[model samples]
Target: MHDTEALQAKFFWFSPGDMTDVRQFFAPGRVNLIGEHIDYNGGHVFPAALTRGVSLWVRPRADGVVRFFSVDFPETIEARVDELEFRPSDGYANYTKGVIKAVQEEAGTLFCGGDFFYMSNLANGAGLSSSAAVEVVTAAAVRALMAYPLDNARIAVLSQRAENDFVGVNCGIMDQFAVAMGKAGHAIFLDCQTLAYEWVPVTLGDYALVITNTNERRGLADSKYNERRSECEAALRRIQEILPDIQNLTQISIDRWDDVETHLASEPNLLRRARHVVFEEHRTNEAVRVLKAGRLAAFGQLMNDSHVSLRDDYEVTGPALDALAEAAWSFSGCLGSRMTGAGFGGCTVSLVRRAAIPEFEEHVRVAYADKTGLQPSFYVSEIGDGVHEQQKEGLEV
Candidate 1:
């Protein structure tokens, strides 16, 4: 556990220069541990909260204005408490606005106004979910300060809606859900369709989760992401006509894959998209079994197969993501590696031994840079807590 003093030091961006008695605060961010681009299709994802997240210190105000400042971006934004709107040009406002819009619509009305001091260090597009983290953290902070009682699941859904509507991005609930509802030292196995989840313990007594950026741009991320969703919907539409009981591709049994060929043949692209979702869901279930048995090597191999399926079958992984995963598989220390996130360009999550940290980092760093000319960034992280409060009386411990 982080001592109060250490936590307070991390909140240096929130200077208490003149004001006092304000205590309620929160810090949370987007996390991508193993699954990527799978949630929208009702596929499983494994993500843990980051030790580094967005910190938001807030206190209610008398006026109906929610004034906020970001320590990370260094900016101030003011919005009417009841009038939550998105600005196309306001980059930072996207998150705050999305949160407010989601909460207000869900809650029917908001109660109070407040100013927030937001601070975060997770870089966006690293496939770490900085934006989703900010949105969730801000929404949570707002609710706490306003004395609103809302469930974390509700908060997650609201934040997701905000991202989809206000931010104009078709984001899945995994990022927001993982940040708001993560547990330490465990990987979350979430049923996207059911929202049912279990904390699958990742007992890496001698290993670690090493993430390396492929340094490729998330080209067609929004486009392909939406396209896949559409394809799934189209498949569901066709399948539903024949089997009215069928909901999403998640409901389709693996054996049923061969049974429903003609309809799938009508739309080759939709067939491909639907195929991945059906198979990946089972992979997630089997992954849990392997992980429970402490079969890191097998689990790692599954990660490799997943990448190949994602690259060849799902058609999301790019050359850089492929190379990054291939390079990690070559390393003796790496148990398994695969491209994480929406994957045009992002980081690859790999299982590595703790004792092999130095050599593993060095080998992948040089190999990736030499091949792509893009210096790969590395982040060494462990599973961290979900949303938490830092009160002034406690000195933010």
Candidate 2:
């Protein structure tokens, strides 16, 4: 845990003035445990919030000017609440600006603007939802300052809107939702189709959840993410010609895929994309069952399957991710390992025996660096709670 008093002092250092009205807020980064690349397809996603994320310290301004400073970034950005627009050059501050605009559209004009100072432990481009974390934290700060009457779920939806419409990333709701509504020590079983969700206990028993970062940065906005989404949409259009009742790729059951396969056989890429969505949905459902039944090994196997489908079918996992996952899989201490997040580049989630964590880390680190020539970073994280205001005695807002 970070020292609240120290963070407050840092905020004063940045602002260089009175700190009386400053308030603190936090939102967590998320890691998808199994389901990958299927959230947009209206399939289930199992994600949990990590202990590491973004933290913000804010002091509201009455002049409608918002100022942002980040310890991790090089410059301080300033903007007006009414003139917020997408500026690719602004970098991380764009998330804050987007959230302010989203809140204004949701609830009339804000009563005030604020100075935001951000500190994050999450690695950039590691696929840990750092962007979503910034958006949610900014939303939480605005809601608290303006008393905007928005709940956590609503906050999540608006944060997603900021990403999709304001930030120009065609992301689904899973990242924002998981970051906004997560509970400590559990994973969220979410149906992307209906937004229905349940919290399942993360009972690893003798195993720990280890995240291995390949250290290869992913530029999702410029990457093939949108192309994949377009491919899936095309596939759905084709399937509707026959099964008009199906709304998404996941709605077509795996048992019925063979029949549907004939319809998509001619379009090889679309067929592969649709196949990954359908089978991944099936794996996610069974993973939940095995997870709840205390079948740890079975759940691990499903994680491995999810990675293979993402690599071969979805074509998202690149060499760095593949090397890390393959190295972890070779270790005897690991029950299962797979690439998580948007793939191409990022981290892998592995279930490693608690007793062998040291050996597991060393073995994978050496093998992965040998193959990819990039040193990998590892984190053994516990599930953590969602976004909220930090309560200090006499300082609670």
Candidate 3:
């Protein structure tokens, strides 16, 4: 919670004098606690939204023009509400425009255009989903401004639509869904294909969730993310030839895997990708079981296994990420560490005792830097609520 009066001074710094009716909203960035790269494969993903996120201060404009100003970036983006399109030079504002376009298309009419001033503390390219944060926060703010009866789930779907259709990124629903429906102190266990979810309470009493950024700055668009997706699609098609009834890789049970394995063995790369998806899905199910039983050590071990499968089978983790994970595993207090996100370069999520965090940070910092020659960043994260309107005295939208 924040003081509305104090936030007014900071949030509306770039506001025009005539703009009086302003409202504040927030959407959070998320970290995948255990599951990784399995979302689009119809597998389970366990992600929790973090307190670190983006904030928006918005007020409707009389002219049907959308103007965006961000404290995080230098350029100001302006456009007509009816003419939103993908522009490479617009930088971060493309996410903002994408959400607006998705919402307008959903509603079948143009609503009020507004001036949006926003800022965020999330690292832009650290694999903590800064793009999803921007898309979700923009969606929520636009929903409020238009007084649309859309729920948070719809907002999340629209945000995913914005990313896939408007921004040209074929992403799964986990990022946007977690950002829109996050709960404090809990992680959402989501079935990416079915979208069935349960809030699993995170009881890491003595353990702390730490994220280490490799600072290699890989964008999902230009990374091998799409190539991986294509590889999986190719594998799925080959498997379907063996068992015509199979719908997705998620349908492959342990008993069925041996039968499907022979079909995929010809293409080593596709075989590896398929193996990762199958095993990671089972790991996610076991994670929920161990987490609920308070078996932190078992859960930690699962995290380590997940990383090995990703590194060897999925082939996403590169040198920098490998070095960071290796460094954390060598540290005494670390229970588990693994590369997270699209994984050519990004962050690693590690679980360590709260008391050991200081020493753990110092050791991993020097060790990872020595191995990669790139200084990494660390964040001790807390789970937080999803996109919502801040409590304050103001006219709604």
Q: Using lDDT as the measure, which candidate wins?
A: 2
* Per-residue lDDT value at 330 in model 3: 93
| lDDT for each residue of candidate 2 in 236-348, tens digit (9 for 90 to 100) | 99999999999989899877898879998999999999999999999999999999999999998999998999999999998999999899889998989999888888899
Query: How many backbone collisions does model 2 have?
Result: 0
- Candidate 1, 1-397: lDDT as tens digits: 3354654554444444333745554555545655556788777887777777776666667787777776545567778867777776667777787787677666777647776666666666777777777887888877776567887777888888888888888888998888888788877888787899998888877889887876667777779888877878888888776668987777788877886666678788877777777777777777788999998888888788778878887898877887788778889989888877777887788999899888988888777877778778787887787776765664442
Model 2 bad stretches (over 4 Å): 1-10, 220-222, 393-397
Q: After superposition, how far is residue 264 of candidate 1 from its true place, in Å?
A: 2.3
Q: Candidate 2: minimum summed lDDT over ten consecutive residues — where?
A: 388-397
Off by over 4 Å in 1: 1-19, 106-108, 393-397
lDDT, candidate 3, 307-356, per-residue tens: 99999998889888999999999988999988878888888999999999
C-alpha lDDT of residue 380 in model 3: 97
Q: What are the lDDT figures for the candidates, one per model?
A: 0.76, 0.90, 0.86
Per-candidate clashes come to 1, 0, 0
TM-score, predicted candidate 2 vs. hidden true structure: 0.96
Write the number of the candidate with greater lDDT, choosing between 1 and 3: 3
Indicate whether candidate 2 or candidate 3 has the larger lDDT: 2
